[model samples]
Target: MESSTEAYVYYDPTKQNAWVDAILNGLGPNKQRYYKVASLQLVTLLVIVIAKTEYFSAISEVETTSCAVGLMNMIGNKGGCAVRLRLYDSYLCFVVSHLAAFTNNCERRNQDFREIAKRVLFKHQSDPSLAYLSHAWNGGGDEGVAYLAHHGTVLDSSKQASVFHADHLIWLGDLNYRINLSEAEVKQRLAVNNYEELLDYDQLMIERRAGRTFPMFEEGPVEFAPTYKFDAGTDRYDTSAKRRAPSWTDRILWKKPILGREGLTQLNYNNCMAMMLSDHKPVQSVFRAQIRELNRQKQSATRRALQQQLTETPEEMAKGTISSSFIEFDDVQFLEYKEKTLVLENTGQVVAPFYFLAKLDEAQAIPPWLQVSPQQGLLGPGEKILLQFEIMIDASVSAPFNQGQELSHILILRLENAKDFFISIRGNYQRTCFGVPLHLLSPMTIPSVNAEASLTSPPERRKHLLQSAKTTLANPSDPPGSVSPSSSSSSLSTSQQANLPKELWRLLTFLWNKNMLTLPNLFLEHGDRMICDYIRKCLDAGDTFDPSILLGEEEDQTQEAVGANSVIDVLVAFLECLPEPVIPTQFYAEALAASDAPDRIKLLKDKLPPLYRNVLLYITSFLADAIQYAPAAVKQDRRSCIVSLFTVLLRPDLAYKETNPALAQLKKEKLISHLLSIA
Candidate 1:
């Protein structure tokens, strides 16, 4: 007896009847003995499946299903033909498609591919009688029986079904993407047998490089000549007047499931030049594929052995050691990133698998801003792994930290079948001007308490002081210099009153005193992180700036100062972090609509609250000074820079639901430009 083989065919019924009949007849008498036609679906196109009779028996009893999607003439003619089946423990899907034709229709081809992948639906056949019996055993009533009878087939209802769920997928068809070169150039390249040079202009390859299509699919390299635009029944190129450029329109691509361990290797990819009945040449690929099989007896035995070993192991054999039980990070500022490394070692003789335990109310083992790489892993005896802990404070989660919330977390690392270790992570979240309400910051006075003394204070006393500060800000009627009872002795003197926050004034004064405004790219690029941190610490502590700290003892007199860029960064950060923009939200539309600098200035003064108006005028005045000091050639550049930087900072923080955010942003830039023209 001959070995059984399977044949799947997808054809246009309008034109391929004779070819189909020929293929069916060529199968011969032995085909009937070994094969059976499992499915025949006819839409505008036809999908015919012929499988070996012994194939089902060899894989045990299960159902195989097929689905089709039509993409021509409103769900007619050409599209995708798919077959899904389970072989052993693996689910495989095979798809064939005929995409859009022509050289410039590559986007259409990609659209067709995406449509077929999304719309193809496969219904798994279920035994209604079996379902009824199971329902009855579970004490279900007539409703369950009626449901089974009404819906005989079960559709896969997963968020993503069909090809996306398969363990291994193979897709092949005439995708019809043409080469980018002109016909004359293509012919010249082909004459020289420069396949590589010609392929560089292939539209499909270009699309893949741009990541517009076939992002996860892999294809074998084409060593053969173009398999398209040939004259039927001849090896010569097309001789007609509409000389189409030769392209590798026919293609075969495959993707491995994200988590599947199976392997697929393409051994050969070539075209059948001898059979030239159509303008397009027939292409084929041979693949070596791996399938998984399950053995229940062996699986059970291994599980039992593992269980016994776990139960009988001595305590010392299961122990693991962590490098540290406590990790302390330096002061974290808004939009700043910090990282630390923790080493984990398996000090045991046996393998150890460990995972972090989440708090009872939390789903994640760590906080949102804190990320732990390799949160769970297995380590062999004497093996060590470095675990990285990173913290970042971005806009989304900055409000709490800016409001004096501490940055701290505790992680519970549990060794499977062993003990749990506690690791405490702590960091001081420095307060910044970014997320504070303008009104609260305007009249609020910075406490004169020593930062080091505050750090060493009792936790309860610190908590009380932070809460009192927030309360004082929350109540607008409270006197500006009101101090929390706990820190009355260290309260700010009335002489320090200012219309704007002290932090903002300090940043501006530094820029002015250091002659930093004319520095190029000062606001455009990031500053030295170490210097920035020191600046932030001083600002938070309300301490006077000590140039010596930054200059160092040797103070290589010739060395350029390093804090200019950092000061600018901190200034921008403060403006961006403000809970409300300097231009209040309610007047955004009116401000953008103002026609002239005088009109914008009038609107700013009239509509903005007193403090907000003060801040806008103050910042723009500094910008005007910067431009005035710039060289004649760079004055316009300086003005443009100020407009660019402040446009985003001063705009309201409302979400733009406009259809075009770019247009709205342009309007804001125009408004800022008007303001800068007269500043």
Candidate 2:
């Protein structure tokens, strides 16, 4: 066989490739350099069975010249050629072919085309096109049938074939041929081959349906159109159209194919698959041709895989066991190591030795979080070995890979008998603009870069840094380029506090708090501090800010409605968070106060949403703060709104569904009122 070079066409960044590289890297400087020596090799080969079907060829070609496409040409050098692939367990190759004005016409009357198709079918072990097995077209008998030399025949397999059947063929196509068998002719034909209408369209009785054998669909007496069109702007007997005339030059043939055609599919079209790259439509069918033995092998392999998962438990097998303690590595990067830092001391004394085989998580194809080990090997007892590596990553990975997001890759270092030690093999995330840490950007004040030029009206530090940032975002390159990573914290205009959306805002806030507290708090006490901050900021300044600018559209002189369409509801809600006594007067006044400075006005208006939200927060905070000391009227108002807020929380996207204490706070705030209302 003069076969072309085989190419896999798979080069994605999959873990298998990474595993191979890591294994090689872990062999150490000498061994790694030795692999570069090009003599050693590790390889595993697999002949994969896959279903490669034209999943959508049928419906897409509806407006084509034909109904079903059949018998496309096949070209392959030797090796029995190639045929359509199928799933492992199925039987019968079902095909729903569409019609074509030019396709399935047996264009050239010779064995050449049929031979090509047959070769292709046998090579890949697939079945025939659906259209080829339908009722004879154009009054022609089953004379046009084409079957492969070594493959099964027929195309009706998908429809009538039973599970026990090998391949009952079904050829679904626009059979442009009209059948005309007299009572005697029908009997004779029936006797010769089991003849029956593949699929019956009303008004096309075998005898009455007989037409110009070329269009087996309908006759022109009822103004039926011809089953073909060659010229443009021609009149048709069927329906209306421009440019080209209309015709029903489509058809489907039927019979049982030997190979499996389980998920046979179809679509109507003017052309067929024969000329898939042509101006006409094409037919597409799915075929499953499994030798029973092959089917058993594939099924057994699949069952074993599923069973492995179904029967798995950490209690069984080598390498290691589970534990939460961190193993000490004197000189180790933990990420990329050329040696196993964990030398299993006293292997005979210890009862087990295990290591993590793979990471478990719900991550995208290539998550940014990854730790690559550069070296590894079995360690013996009583050896204090040196394993060195670096923690490599960016801030994105260290958004702390938890269990759901990731099952937490605690690199299991198992000492023979001791419980498995888990080290967080997560990337070390570092983020900076130029060289300045993003954390440095967190504080509310920073010095002006141009402080030397203007001292008399020296700009405030936060304002200067903000203006500098605005300038940087606008024009990344400074006219007079300058940068200083050691710069101090800059002031924030309350809301650019974080440009993150509320959902991400919550995450960003957590990250910020983590940087502040250096630990995930016990029972989220930081949440209390956070809510208090929100309340203070909201009551004092939240309402003063304009949400119209931040959350919605900013007015543009040229385009008045060019801003985003957003309601100030969240901002408004923030105002309602404040304590009742201070809110109606203090916060509301703060909200409505006019700012003469446009910048200050924008700033203050922007503060309004947060302020309004804090009104609600403060009310809740007061209940916590005042305990039972609240005034009767104020307490009553809080009681009423708390119930309403709980009802509002039935919605999904808002604050309540959150797992944080905030959601619990909302729920808890309503608990007393909930009982009273129910009572």
lDDT score of residue 394 within candidate 2: 26
Candidate 1 Cα outliers beyond 4 Å, as residue runs: 1-324, 330-339, 343-353, 379-384, 392-403, 416-420, 428-444, 447-497, 510-567, 579-609, 628-631, 651-661, 677-679
Candidate 2 lDDT over residue span 153-246, tens digit each: 2222222221112233343333333323233343344344433331232223332335212221212121222233332232222232332322
Candidate 1 on 546-643: residue-level lDDT in tens? 77655445644221235565676667767766666777665676776673345556755555555566566667666666666556665664565456
Q: For model 1, give the 10-residue run with minimal summed lDDT.
A: 1-10
Q: What is the lDDT of candidate 1?
A: 0.61
TM-score for predicted model 1 compared with the true structure: 0.42
Best by TM-score: 1
**Count of backbone clashes, every candidate in sequence:** 2, 124
- What C-alpha lDDT values do all the predictions have? 0.61, 0.28
